[model samples]
Target: MDQTTTARAKGSRKPLWTKDFLITALANLLLFFSFQMLIPTIPIHLSQLGGNNVQVGLVIGIFTISSLLTRPFAGRALDILGRKHVLLVGLTICALTIAGYTYIAAVTLILAARFVHGIGWGLSTTSLGTVIADIIPPERRGEGMGYYGLSNTFAMAIGPLTGLWIMQSYGFSYVLLISTILAILSICSSLFIAYPKPIPPTNRAKSQRFTDRLWERSALLPSSLLLCTAICYGGIVTFITLFGHEAGIPNVGFFFFCNASMVLLVRPITGVLFDRKGPEWVLLPGAAFTITGLLLLSYANSNLSLAIAALCYGVGFGSIQPALQAWTISRAAPDRRGAANGTFFSANDLGIGLGAMVLGAIANWSGSYALMYRFSSTLIIVFLLIYGWSIWSYSLHKKAAH
Candidate 1:
């Protein structure tokens, strides 16, 4: 048998963990830990700087806008410029911007720093996804990605809690220092990874139109679905702390802890299910869980209710996200995987950015975070409808082909 077939057979027989995979996963974990540490805390920081909800949303959302804009170009660059160079530069930028947060005395400066940070985020994340895709065995992609996603989950579980505690105990400056250190460590870990050699762009790849280079068509469906889900996620990450205060809860960070814990539990199972069954089986139940969680969260008044909502949302999001990612990668040609990852993440950033801005406005207009969450739940319903339509249309197309 040829090497590809031989590798597949071996992969099927044994687990797909390599030293490179472990190091890469570690790097991803540290990178996300640094990012996640700031997700909930930044709004609080902005609030202390005399920013209102609208300003908070703009500052937070603008980061994703810049990240979103950078992703398309970053994706193309990965295909041309080589992964290590992109990854290191991105990490370095992230570290510097994160450190700059400590010195910012005004919300406007924070906004500018966040925007610059997004560029690094876009570049690093796309490169990481592409690098991991290269390391993973195709036959076991779902499983590998699930395990890989656990790194993010682990970061989510600890990063927010740690950040909030540090902010509460020491101050925001200490939080920035620690986060910057974590990001630097991430860069260090990435240095050890053996990146795959870039495949030289074919003449056709080189001659592709500018617009065509920005996205991969094969990834559109899954990316679209992920975008919808990310909108809801943006609301949670951006406002959950404020919501907790509104509901009279003492500690809001527990919600993230519970949510991430459930994700840690569910991701592996969902990954296996996706490998054995398909995206449909994982996605349908996941959507239901997410919708239910959102509704529950909208009404949550106590820790118990919050925990329940978090668990449901966690199961839904954790399962759906990796499945969509694996689906996106599986559909793309090897040389185009970077672009596919870019498209996938771009959709994510767009959704989050839009969600933050729109939902912030809703929260301000209604003067109720609870009402905002109720509205957020509706978007997932849209996700369900779209997915249902896609499935129906796909079935019809298959029947016609047959």
Candidate 2:
């Protein structure tokens, strides 16, 4: 090949993995690991502190509410203040608040701490996602996002189990200490990641002076769809363990182990399919898988049945998440990507918060987590139909343009 042709080939070859990406992913994993450890422990801690179900729910609920409230501002901060600044601030706050848990016993104090922690979570996660979007090559976006998302997947797999073991073996104080230490480690790792300079906003330059900046219109559609999927996912996270206990399953941790394992195994393939064949090829079948998993979970009686459900849900979630993120990224202008990611995550957290309340109520009303899963399955089917309609409409629009 000629010298120019060889150079072109090298330039066009997108690097799916990079040093910055790896550092960011590792930092993200540590951050999530620290957060996830607190998830199960917090409720137990609150109960031990003489809190009832209502108080426990309020303490848990406030965190997401705070995060959702913070995300829009965090998005704007990423664009205006730059990524590294916001990220470091977030990690510091997260670490400090977690450490604060060691000193607090009052439910009110705990609620305050939780809100601060959620703010930290919001800022850090939004900045992290924007940083990845800034660095990842456009051609390799789906593949890159898949690998990045695996960090969170791994955290989900291992964090709760480790936290529960630590808390059970030692005490809640030890869990707090360990989580705080991990948060510090996450900050240290984040320091090594080099973020690119922010792109100056062009379209919104005039409006920035006067208008509110909470939502990114470009990110709305995909984010909305993500909200739907996350509602069902949140239900799974909130009740799956309890559901297992109620159903007479002894080793419920195996379900999460299976779920995360499938996600890890299938993500690379789904990413490739997303890049090569577009999201329609992945998303339609992914929705089917998710619905099927929910159905299986609803009926599961044995370990084998639960494993199958986890496998299906894992594959479906692994496929759909990166594809939706890639789609959201594609819709935004370069300068607006930070807001895009913020909107995306905000919708996600909202769904989780809503699902916890709504689906929990359903479980309580029906007196069965299994029935709640059945309800969640129906929601997924509705989401699929909506997603399908959007794809169809977009296709028609493209044809009309042609």
Best by TM-score: 2
TM-scores of the models, in the given order?
A: 0.89, 0.93
Best by lDDT: 1
Model 2, range 1-402, lDDT digits (tens) per residue?
A: 012123233446577578898899999999999999998899899999998888888777888999998888888888778899999999899999999999999987898899999999899899889888877777667777888888999998899889999999999999999999999999999889888887777875537642345567878888978888899988988898899988988887788899899999888888777766677777888888999999999998889999999999998888988888877886777777778888999999999988898999999999999999989988777777777788788789889999
Give the clashing residue pairs of candidate 2, or none.
Answer: none
Q: CA lDDT of each candidate?
A: 0.88, 0.86
Stretches of candidate 2 exceeding 4 Å from the true structure: 1-11, 208-212
Q: Which regions of candidate 1 deviate over 4 angstroms?
A: 1-14, 40-57, 102-107, 202-204, 245-248, 364-368
Q: Tens-digit lDDT track for model 1 on 1-402?
A: 012223345534445699989999999999999998897799899999999878887766688788999998888888878889999999999999999988889988998899999999999999999999888887667788999999988987888778999999999998999999999999999999998898887787778898897788878988999999999998988789889999998887889889989999998898878766677888899999999999999999999999999999999999999988988888877788889999999999888877777898999999999999999988888888888988888889889999
lDDT of 1 at 171: 92
